[model samples]
Structure formats: C-alpha cells, structure tokens
Target: MSEMFQTYERQYQELVSGLKQGCVAAGALNEDQRRPKVPELKTALDEGDSLIRRMDLEARGLQPPQKTAFLGKLKNYKAELTNLKREVKMMSMGAGAREQLLEGGQFTTSQEQRVQLAAATDRMYQTGDRIREGKKVLVETEELGVSILQDLHRQREVLQHSKNTLHGVDDNIARGKVIIHNISRRITRNKYIMAGLIIFLLLAILVIATGKRHQG
Candidate 1:
C-alpha cells in the first residue's frame, strides 16, 4: 500500500511540475509569439487531462476530499485549455477573413471581423487572468501540502510516545510478577522453619518433665 501511495504521489508531483513549467513558459512569451504558443499550451493541457483521468481511475481508493480536489483541478485545467483553443481559432479565422476582405486595396471595416477580434481579445485577457489564478492555486496547494506533512509528523510523534509508555508499563508488570513470586517462596520456606522450631520445643518440655518425675 505504501508503495502504491508513493507511486501515486510521484506521478501527481510530476504532473504538477509539468503544468507549472508550461504556465511559466506561456507567461514568458511575447505578444507576437502567443498565438504560436497556443498549440503548445493545448498539448500540455491535453496531457494533463489524460494523466488526471488515469489517476482518477487507478487511484479510485483516494479519500473523498482528495478525489474532489483532484477533480476540481482537472476541471479548471480543462476549461482553461478549451478557452485558449477557442480564442486562438477565433483570432486565426478573423485574420484569414480580414485578408480575404482586403479586396481591391480597400481593407476597410468588417463588422464580423471586428466582432471576432473583440471576442478573441476578451478571451485572451481571460486566459491571462486564469493563468494568474492558476499560480495562486498552486501556491495554496503547496501550503496545504506542507500543513498535511506537519500534521503527519505530529501524529508520528504521538504514536512513538505511546509505544514508549506501553513498553515501560510492560517492564514494570514483569518486575512486579518476579517480586511477588520471590515473596511467595520466602513465605513457604518460613512456614517449614516455623513447624520445625515448634516440634523441637515440645521435645525439650517432655524431656524436662520426665527428669522431674524421676527426681520425685
């Protein structure tokens, strides 16, 4: 069980690290490169989703709270990926359409293109917001993990103390048994000595009485 738990933990950590790295890479891109980076972001998100599902299925024995939190994280990651994909596709289509509308050297206003552009821009901003929120979530999760570790440590200490106390009690009980046995043996020996002394005294009294009779 411990081995399985360790394996699960290692996979979880690796997945989280990959996600954080992907986010950092996304955040570091310049404006000109963001659209191109969308493909990479989607790939990362897809991999995350795949891993999450596998973990969910394999680690079905997870406690309810952990499973709930895991599912929540997966949902957030999946949603962000979908939003980014939509934004990228919209922007790309708008760009292509605008080029085609640049007919006869007159590239003027197109309402549909404008609408798509606006929507794309909104989604872009939303994605940025989500990225920041993801960072916050990661930080909070790390703190929570630390707290859990501390609690485990405290519980281990308590168990160790209890074990020591039990050992001491066992040792004391053994000593008490030995002492009682010795006391019982001594009492038995004293009984035998006491009987012998009484017998000797009776013999002496009888001998004295017989001597007195002879003298009379």
Candidate 2:
C-alpha cells in the first residue's frame, strides 16, 4: 500500500473508534446529555464517509487485480459506516423510542458480531489475494523455464550443423591430399623414362660413327 493510503486508513480507523466511543457514551447518558453529543457523532459519521470515498478513489487508481483485492475491505468499511449512522440516528431519537429499539441488548450484540464477521471476511480476502500473487509468480517462472529450454534446443541444433560442416571440410581435405600424392608419383616416373630414351639415342649414334670410319 502507498503511504497516502495508509494515512487515510489510519484516519478512518480513528474515526470509527471515536464514533463507537461516542455512541456508547451517549447510550449511558440521559436525554439532555445525549442531545449535545448527537451533532458530534454526526460530524464523525460525515468524516468517515468522506474518508471511505477517498479510500475508494485510491483503490480505483490501482491495477485491476489490486483493485479487486481492495474491494472487500472497502465494502466492509461502508457497512461499518452504515452501522455507525444507524447508531447515531438512534441516539438522536427520543428516550422511549431508543429503549424500544435497543431492548434486551440484542441489537448491540448483533452489531458486534457483524463487526467481527467483517474483520474475519477481510482477513479471508487478504489471504486469497496472497494466493493469487503466488500463483502469478509461479506462472511467470514456468514460462521462463520453458523459454530457456527452447533456447538450449536451438543452440544444440546450431552446434550439430557446425560439426557436420567441419566433417565435410575434413573429407574434402583428405581427398585433395591423396590426389596430390598420386600426381607427384606420376611426374617422377615420366622423368625416369625420358632419361632412358636420351641415353639409348646417344649410344646408337656413336656406334654408327665407328662403322663409317672402318669402311673409309
């Protein structure tokens, strides 16, 4: 929660507490004594109403999920304010009418039970909000894990392709080495054959020259 929202909430709680105290005090007093306190209770009620409106405005400014989380609290506050207003109205009533409505303390007990129920409901809503937040985090983490796996798969495919390309280059290099070795052997054999033919031609020429000399 924002600091401003916290401040508003604190003020609202104070108003609620003050209103409850005023109602209880007024209940104990006689008609004349309660008359003066009625205006004070009404003023606190108005302030509480205004604070709730402001708190609601703040809630509306929140993101949808957070706003939803705050709705239950806001609703509880409104209900409490309504109850306070009813109490103030009763205080403003004549003694006879007030006694008839509040006879046997049943109404006060019921009101206290409603307040407790509202508090419990607020706690339940908060718990639900926390659960939703945890679920959202888990979902994001799962998506991240999936994305990492996909990236690793792509990298593995690239590495495999590169390995294949290297193997093809190695095969071509091996073939080229064999062809060079064969060409070198063929050139050496042709040189030996040429040398033998030159030697035979010279020997034949010498023999013919000696025979000519003998005939002369």
Candidate 2 regions with alpha-carbon error over 4 angstroms:
1-107
Instruction: Count residue pairs with overlapping backbones in model 2.
Output: 0
* TM-score between candidate 2 and the true structure: 0.48
Q: Candidates' lDDT values, in order?
A: 0.63, 0.77
Model 1 lDDT tens row, 1-216: 334544644665576566556556755765445655655555555455444444444344467876676656556645655655564454334455445655546534675566566567658856865875676567557656866787799999999999999999999999999999999999999999999999999999999999999999
Worst 10 residues of 1 by lDDT: 88-97
How close is every model to the real structure, measured as TM-score? Answer: 0.45, 0.48
Q: Which lDDT tens digits does candidate 2 get at residues 161-211?
A: 999999999999999999999999999999999999999889998899989
The most accurate candidate by TM-score is 2
